[model samples]
Target: MNKLSVKVKNLVIGGNSPIVVQTMCNTHTQDIEASIAQCKDMVAAGTQMIRLTTQGLDEVNALRVIKEQLHAAGIHIPLVADVHFNSDVAIAAAKVADKVRINPGNFAQVHKDAAVQFKKFLEICKENNTAVRIGLNHGSLGEEIVNKYGNTPLGMKEAVMQWLSMCKENDFYNVVVSLKASNTVVMTEAYRLLHNAMQEDGMLFPLHLGVTEAGNGDQGRIKSAVGIGALLKDGIGDTIRVSLTENPVNEIPAGHTIANFFESGENEILLDSVMAQIRRGSSKPEAIISVNSALCGNTDTRSQDAWNEFIIKASCLFGPLLLDKQIDDFDAVPNFSHAHNHDHECEHTNEHSSDHESNDAEEQIFVEMKKIFSADRLVEFKENLMQAARRKFTHPEYIACPGCGRTQYNLEQTFNEVKRRTAHMKGLKIAVMGCIVNGPGEMADADYGYVGQGGHKVTIYKGKTPVLKSVPEDQAINALIKIISES
Candidate 1:
């Protein structure tokens, strides 16, 4: 692919440059102050570019004011004017804005001079040396293309190709192409196919990425991340936006997160792994505790105090029991036989005579809990709880396993019941793991959970901490509900 050098302020799109994160302002562009303030917020949050809707002359008027304010503040980020329906707005915005985005499907005339008028708009943009973006949305495809190919990825791609062809025919190579769809699967698949097609044809058009109308907050962020993040992993997108129904400023963070995925290679650890790791205990001892002694170089008092408190609580819960040889070496420990007998024996003896021990079981339990409850562990537990709570209360999240004969309850049925009951919640996470062997670890991050044990028995946890065990099968949901409600 040839390097792209379409200038937006001082930043260049495409080529070896870092991915550009962009978002559209949700405020009425006619309100210059509101639009300028929102743009300032987006700039502060690391947005590389911003687009404002330019419906006609009135919005164009606001654009002029916005340009003045941006210049006064010395903010030089590229500003794109989003135009539709009228070529006049596009022509007018090209006079002042950094770039002008046009939807070809709507930029038409009802008379014989339509083509002439459209050419005039392009000529004006060319004269001003402003770049153009040919943005094609699946929701607003031209009637001819939709009728020929239906509303599939193929149709969206065709619409974009047609626009690009027009730009090429008119010698407008300073253009970007975006083929967007709201469906995550379609959006991702279409971009992949189009990207390949463009490569095969030697078309080096810079691609702008987005998933349109992606709801609000977590849902929107998740959908955009999955769609845009996937393409970015393959080195396909050059610019991106996260379209949400909420405040436009919120979109800036989401865009930056996606861009940073490609810029820093952080998405490899972020996707499908953050939640999983939170469920499984960390492999490193340093991950288990977050201490702030001068030796460790931590000076934050709040973090140090939190670490101390957690250690105290965890030690209190498990300290005495671990000190008892019988309980410490019990079969409950997974892979007890895998360790070298000498090492296992050493671990057992160390716990028994350790300074963490107490004569009283209750006191020992608290001490043990505290020892295990370092700041890192506490933070991990809280993250898990928040994820489970969000899933339980909001969307369809599952806690299934690699099934075995020990399983009694229908895991799928339990999952559906919990999801249905908690769908009204905005941020609830519930887990339904199969058996006690792996249930506690699997449901460690859930806000409320149910794990099937032997016949008719279930264990419940509220955010990694076990609240109740051995509740009968019939009362599991009710128990979980009560715990979640109280929490």
Candidate 2:
């Protein structure tokens, strides 16, 4: 980890400081009473910081009043003014608020001479001991940057990089940064690329992780969990805010849940393991084979219905998408196991065969064995048996996650479609995961990953990093086709 720390309103952030939990108030900032009430409510829910939208001078005035009210009432929460398209407002808010967030695109558009405006803005923030967050939203990058980088993750990182450079050039380092998207994969990868860029530049400004427009209810919670949790597991985020369509208070615990899970005393190793797995992308071949073989031949519990049970259990280990996207509950699995062990039959036939017609007998035994294992055994044969035995694969390995509350599309159907299209591309291990949260860590060994990023959107990845993002539901499959064809 790079050496860096930032101080905001008496609180230390970045480096080894505990991950901060934040949430933005949805109440209109101009409505002073409503703003104070909502912000207080959020603080009660454990939000360490609060962001309020300051669209213009009026909101700045409202922020000042809200700050006063909180102080008079004996509360000491740091206030952040979210300003876009208004450097004058940002300058004013910076004088009062603990932090002022400005969009690089908005600053460039609002001030004709952005260099002069940004210099003055930095001066005000520096003087007031106010921190700055050069917020970059994926859908809001400037036209020139878009033309150059194609509204992609690279474009998002470049937009922030330019501004970050400006701050450093002016000798201003009290900066936090955010590179966000509604799409989880894009958001996660952009943060990763930006983090690495900062590390190379020797700047470890704390990152604020979020997935914008994460809609309400259980859907919102799970989506935020997957994206935020994934990053936290890899030790990427410093502070986080769960962006939701509901009341701002609802977003607090979601962010806290992720922070809490990774920060748990016992889960420290789990987090480290996830990061290592993602970096290496695959484990030793011997290790994987040994585990699979042991799983396949569990002699400790061999019974009347052992073989089928073994196949089902092994399929569940890799995921049931191989056997067909159905239930995996052990109780519901029933007596799918077979009455006899097929491997012993081949050996017995070989031993009893007469010398005169040995080849024909062997052929007969082989055909019968194939017939016995052929039904409901396509997945177990290629993925389990052949893979464990280290033999040549007979089919392309398609790995996909069963859908969860966070999943946006019909994952089972999508997996089938992907397999139907790419079954001919043998010897490849491709993964399809429900969301970016698990895609990178879980599918580390896969050659490619097709992950759900947002509603009706997919992000295609070459291993752990994203290659294509925010492809529409209709075109994502085709985009995947292009990735495969090109690769």
Candidate 3:
């Protein structure tokens, strides 16, 4: 079924439009200048839409000024207000932001009250010609939905469908919907279920695809690519956001890589070739053991962007197969030949000498293999890939939010600390969240969580129960570590 397009300012999402890539700002919305600066950076990085954290009325007012300043500077990029647990804020933000993102599950306390508030918010959105995203996360499903569907993909679909029903009843169509999860299997399956349900209902709203709480670095990228790529492969996703714990600007290039790979029409040739390779590789036992030159496809791993592109391609190729249980493990190490560029070697070895050390062809192969795909590096990548696919867990799975204005603490630094300290522990889903608003609920599946509370405090949780509350910011990590160790 053809999806209905939702327009946010000059950007059109869904229908026959291109897959738009977007990112959210982490700067405090109250700091209008910093928000504006971040917005400028995000825009320069090719972000189609920008979402800022809007937690209260004060932030809404700040958002107004930020948008005004951006427009005055000739940047008409659509600004989205990400509102959670507040209906009134969502309504107020609709008038100012080009789009308003709300998770209806938390719009109000009571389910019925949420419906009423959501309707009121929709009325305002319609009046102001603002786009809406009925964004729902797997870990944040409402109690009622969880009661009925056990917090599974069905629950997510059922919850979002309720809001979509309200939209249909109210004749509101300028809306996009998302069901994000950190687990690639859950994320992809949820979207697929929702897509089929929408098709059955005879109206398909555009999907905003993402892997929520996907942590930083290569794992984040691979996990996001796997989840979002699976959905896009089935012609499901409309707009994509590669959420990372690092700088939001880094998200744009990663998002674009995934978007470009699955883009329709002209890119279909590349997509088919890659998909065919994945299919062939996953089918036979012999194919599974080796990662040869052909497995890398035509992507030349010699340029500046080669490593990043390879990560995207590798995830896209192997993720689906692993997620679907077609292959359990790959035995042999990938040994793609490095391009014979001495300059690239110098960049790595930091050697200015042109006449470098001499080596035979066999010795050179060993050197390249050791430098690029060492045994330890291969194991790390495999473990992460396995964890991303949810097939195995050899290391602690980190679920972290990309810091937003609500994040009062140094989220990136704190999360890294949590990861470093907890690296030795295996099979634990540890979450290092930014703030209390959505942290506890979003990290519902985590065995342990480190949530930031305001006023330089932190809350430690053990499976939805607050084990330690109001620990000092400096001591929170130690407390969390102790709790995990004691358990």
Cα error, residue 277 of model 1, in Å, equals 12
lDDT of 2 by residue, 318-424 (tens): 22111111221111111223433555533433343442156543233333333234334433333443332223365665555433334467665777788779878
In model 1, the runs with Cα more than 4 Å from the true position are 108-117, 268-487
Candidate 3: list runs displaced more than 4 Å. Answer: 110-112, 264-305, 330-332, 335-379
lDDT of each: 0.61, 0.65, 0.81
Q: Determine which window of 10 residues in candidate 3 has minimal summed lDDT.
A: 284-293
TM-score of each: 0.58, 0.58, 0.87
RMSD of each: 17.6, 15.6, 5.7
lDDT of 3 by residue, 318-366 (tens): 6776787767764224444553343344244322122124543333333
Descending-lDDT candidate ranking = 3, 2, 1
* lDDT (tens digit, per residue) of candidate 1 on 1-487: 6545477657788777787888777666887888889889989988888888786788888888898889899988788998756777788999988889887655642224545666777788788888888887655666777689876788878777766676667777778778776555567767877887777777768889976644443444555665676577678888998766455676776676557545765444332332343346532111121121231223332343434333322221222122221122111111212322322322333453443345542233233333433434444333322232221122434333322223457654665577578766655555666667545643424566677887788888877777898899889988988888887
- Candidate 3: lDDT over CA atoms? 0.81
- Say what the RMSD of model 2 is: 15.6
Q: Kindly indicate the candidate among 1 and 2 with the higher lDDT.
A: 2
